[model samples]
Target chain A: MVSEFRIRTETESNMAKQSGSNKSRLYVPEPPFRPGDTPDYSHISVPAAHSPVRPDPLCDADETRDHATSLIRVMRFNGETQGDWVPGISPEIKRTALRDIALTRAMDERMFTMQRQGKMSFYMKSTGEEAVSVGHSLALQDTDMIFPTYRQQGILINRGASMKEMMCQCLSNSGDPLDGKSIPVLYSFKKHGFFSISGNLGTQLIQGVGWAMASAYKNSDEIASVFTGEGATAEGDFHYALNFASTYRAPCIINVVNNQWAISSFQGIAAGEGETFAARGTGYGLATLRVDGNDVLAVYAATEWAAERARRGGGATLIEHFTYRKSGHSTSDDPSKYRPESEPDVWPFGDPLERLKTHLILIGEWDEERHVELLESCKKQVRETYKSAEAMGNLSGETRVNDFTMFEQVYEHALPHLDEQKRMFAQERD
Target chain B: MPQMNMIEAIRDALDVKMSQDSDVLVFGEDVGYFGGVFRATAGLQETHGLHRCFDTPISEGGIVGIAIGMAANGLRPVAEIQFADYIYPAYDQIASEAARLRYRSNGDFTAPITIRTPVGGGIYGGTTHSQSPEALFTHIAGLKTIIPSNPYDAKGMLIDAIEDNDPVLFLEPKRLYNGPFYGDPHAPAKTWRGHELGEVPSGHYTVPIGEARKISKGGDVTILAYGTMVWVAQKVAEDMGLEADILDLRSLLPLDIEAIEKSVKKTGRCVILHEATRTSGFGAELAAQVQERCFYALEAPIQRVTGWDTPYPHAQEWAYFPGPKRVGNALRSVMEG
Candidate 1:
């Protein structure tokens, strides 16, 4: 039926061309499925596991051109691991990965509920794209810097950032380290090697490249990793980052989380129609890979490969994490209004957390009973952390950030004008 | 001491800092092998090697963004935007990222980057090449805006800016690159050979940001100007035979309100001048600051001499420029009231 419709549309288009029509019209891309329609991702191609062979970490960028088009999946849907891309990490690490992914989802759920309850102003969930951050974080050294978008909270989670502090930031309470200066979830953890999150999309890509350049200039062993959504690839900073990374051979890894949706607009709006996002890096003469983001082993192996290449001064790599956003863009969005209500259930890439758990169980590293117990413990931990963070303050509570902090941190030292303005502001309060 | 033009002085400053601090980097479009379009970064790449002084792609957003990252990573990067008019493309990086990095990160990270760009008119480069965007940067917090009108201040302030812990927008007046302009386009070109302010001291010296220089002292009226307009104001006061107290505001954001108040209170009148457009220009801020600090001392309403609120036109550049004639009229008007 789909082929017949395609043939009929092509025939009509060809007839219109033959009728001497020279009118030019603007073309806007529309998604494959809309509200009330059945979301059928079966039309989309999903290659089998271990289909594309992994290249050597030090291979020339041109050698990875084929890899950019094919998927580097390690775990099959049946929970059987079979591929060179499989990262044979220890069983303990596999269990830890599963726990971290589960905890990230649990925390996301709790914070989202808090926002809906008016306890916080906003929240963004990583949802089905957990492995993109957790796997990458675990693969890279703890000292390596990470410039992330708002959605990569899993990086901080895997880095052992205090859940109370993260919750306090989200609640914008007195304990919020940012002092209510930043939007909720826009975290900055210097101690954890996580760069401050900038709400402006794609600005951090170039910064990561710059950081890598600085590392190389100083002859340091550390490399930088940066992440942005597929939607933000259209931003000029992304291209600039790739240009500099390839030109100077900066030691860095650039990850584009292609979750198939960018809020109300789909990935096609970002020029994801005919070409893959990973292919964008191939044009810049950088090694590029497309991995199954839901498969934790694949994400870990790809990130490890990229990190090894970067640390060895072999240049940068761009990895596209093919997955699906299984939730609304943010607390303020309603995905059902634009997309099918069953879209998340029908997504081709299954839940990242569930897949990792299944793979662990298949390898005799985890079981159904332990998975349930881990899920409960994660929820309990989130609840207890929220309680402690709530005691400090919340958006709806009487406790608030100190008003005086508003006049601080404008510069390293307070200038005369800022001093005068602070005095005036104090006087007004008095 | 050496007699240097603004461009040479700026280059000398970069060279001095690069020699002093190994972490100091100089880069921008055409700044490496070509020595920059205006020659402001001439001969630095050869002296410092390609690693320290290199060329980047023509991406202002990328240039500033990467500079911010480098700054956070313990490098004092001095990135140049070839022209001030081309800075809008990177405004987001400058205003949103650089300006807010220190504040948003709660002092955990800071972008101590110095963005040096050529500004102001009289070069006849038209809308794309000529602009005075000091006001645009002055409006942003966590940013220190500086515009030097002479060779000595240019070198000293650029050095200070590179060392400062905050992001500094060093706007070098292209019109005063070789010699100071006194608002006369048709006058024979001048050089900095014998000018008193052109004798820049070699090596290290700090002029301090947020401080104003009293170019010429008087008690009749206070004239506030910056960049090339400093010379225009001095020329207007001399040509009109008025003993005006002209203050060259080297810094705009952390304005030397003390100097402004003292001058305005002593003179009882004030006139603000700039080359940027009239509406919401830095002149407006000067006027407001003057009145707020010296409101009771103010004898007449503050007067402003500025370019018209229009896109800088190629032809009729003189009319668009707030020249000596317009400044003279403003000075006379303020004195009369």
Candidate 2:
């Protein structure tokens, strides 16, 4: 027994010696900044303004690989459009884009407050990610279908979805267009080319590719745009979309909003520690671009480039929009748990609203007084819309969704079972 | 009319739909060039153009999600999942996107997509390839689940499922692809030549989505079955000399409640049969509904003959399946009381 103990101890020592010599251990990824740590932006690297030159839309996909690694920026920090990537647009359109961005942020704030006040169930804010959707919306045609994530409410807002109706959907009130079928923020403005927002992530990517394929098959010029976060790129559907997109050369644009964080986890968990999300597109032989998402001009210009490419028979283009999630992931999330409170302040790219406003002011297109007035006007309009939606009914009040809605739309042609259920439910409610 | 098997019937439905409507497209893994693994989509690519019938990567989520997109854009997409076992990966897309499109969009958008999968055991496929997932799809609110036991019903129901304005899960019993599986490993495969439900028409005909076919009529006991169990129950009843009213419940969702109530009340006895596991299988739903609707008229408690609650094993499948003896015992028990 003593000899056995000796041998076991000897073996243990031997393993310790081997491990000490090898120094091998499991590698766990850690976030750049943890809670209680001072927020730091030194690790992040952003390319100079307009570092990537604009290529011809018809250029071979392989020729645009470099664009996937470097950043494409049009608006500088000093409020001037720079380099060849600048999209020449009239002042009216730029002002309209700015207005839509403000409106989106205003709506997000109102909805967030409503959730806190027990008037709504949930809310997700696009606080720092506004440019990604608004820029794409302004660049694409109104008929171009968009399969967007919940954070891209700017698509519907820019397309003129009624603010009152949107508020009613959040409240699940009488004026709710969906008749209380979906949860809050799952908006579907089908007539405005806004595809229904699916709570499941990464589903819309393949859907966008398929929509583009159908449009191509029908010989239509209309293209499709899909949005997903950086973390969703790890899903199998993302890879499938790229494979189908490259094989069929579907006319679509895949926008990956790399907002630095995915819920509680950081972006590194999805893209790995060493690789960029934009590099994934180049691997699939797709035309790719990495844009500064906080720079509204850059986002707009990049979307226009990809949209034009898709319109003229070019294949899909993947654009990685680098930004940060300024607020928590949603009302239910607490950013302080996973990230330093100071992270948003030290973000490399500033706020999207401020960047666009600075550009407009730099070009003498507007003044500070006008900016204040626009901000107040957006807040007041959203507040009024909320009041009207509340008048229709809140969750606890008289809702517009009837008992029959549960059985309705299960099929376009109602089966006997559903018909019976509808009648029974109506009687029970009465 | 041409006599065909279940696989042939499926292929005929695709051919008919593609020929009639230019908007219908067929796609899935290996469906374009090699036909499907089970040959259910054989000759479709050749008959239709490559654009209309094509292959996709072995990504079920992408297949279903992309098909939903096509359906929303005014195309009827028939997506083939190689097996029911591999369909779990696509459940999110099928349940969240395609099923809810019309409801979420308030009738502005609808996904007219049909997902076809070969289901059931008895092919020595083990746990990976054989699974009866009809219950999973049936539980989804906006999805329709259909299973056909014979060639005629296979063709007619598949055509109707494809042309339907909502998402349908067309589950083909892999065991009944070429011949009916009566749960006897030693017995020779039975072709549809002499079967009552085998005479399939060449052109378009539809077995409506919500009706049940009364295969045989007797008043002693009512037997409800679908897919492989329908044949198994029929064979069991004949062998046992039991006067059974055998009903083929083709559609699990949107069930024929009227027919079920009528038959169960008249017979005063019921035995539910399925190859899926006994617990929480579709048979349970049938039993609960039967008891709820015809409890006062029932002379005996409803009995269920189903596969055991275990993964389908390769060598021990026969023991796990609800074979003739098990079904016969259930029939006797119900009739005796």
DockQ, per-model, please? Answer: 0.85, 0.66
The digit string of per-residue lDDT tens for model 2 on A1-430 reads 0111011223344555665555665545567568998876654555554377788999999878988877888887788888878898888888988999999999999999889988878889999989888888999999999999989998888899998988888888879888887889988888889988888889889999999999998898899999999989999889988888888899999999999888998887786666678889988999998888998888899999999999999899999998889999999999999999988988878899998999999999977999999999999999998898889887765766675676677779888877877788878888
Query: What's candidate 1's DockQ score?
Result: 0.85
Runs of candidate 1 with Cα error greater than 4 angstroms are A1-19
Candidate 1 residues A1-430, lDDT tens each?
Answer: 1121111223345445653366554445677778988877776556664358888999999999988888888888878888787786999988888889999999999999989999999999999998899999999999899999988998999999999999999988899999988889999999999999999999999999999999999999999999999999999999989999998899999999999888888887897366788999989999998888998889999999999999998999999998889999999999999999998998877888888888888888889999899999999999999999999999887548998897888899998888888899989989
Which numbered prediction scores highest in TM-score against the true structure?
1
Question: DockQ score of candidate 2?
Answer: 0.66
Q: Identify the candidate with maximal DockQ.
A: 1
**Native contacts retained, all candidates in order:** 0.80, 0.70
Estimate, for each residue in B7-37, the C-alpha lDDT of model 1 and write its tens digit: 9999999999999998999999999988999
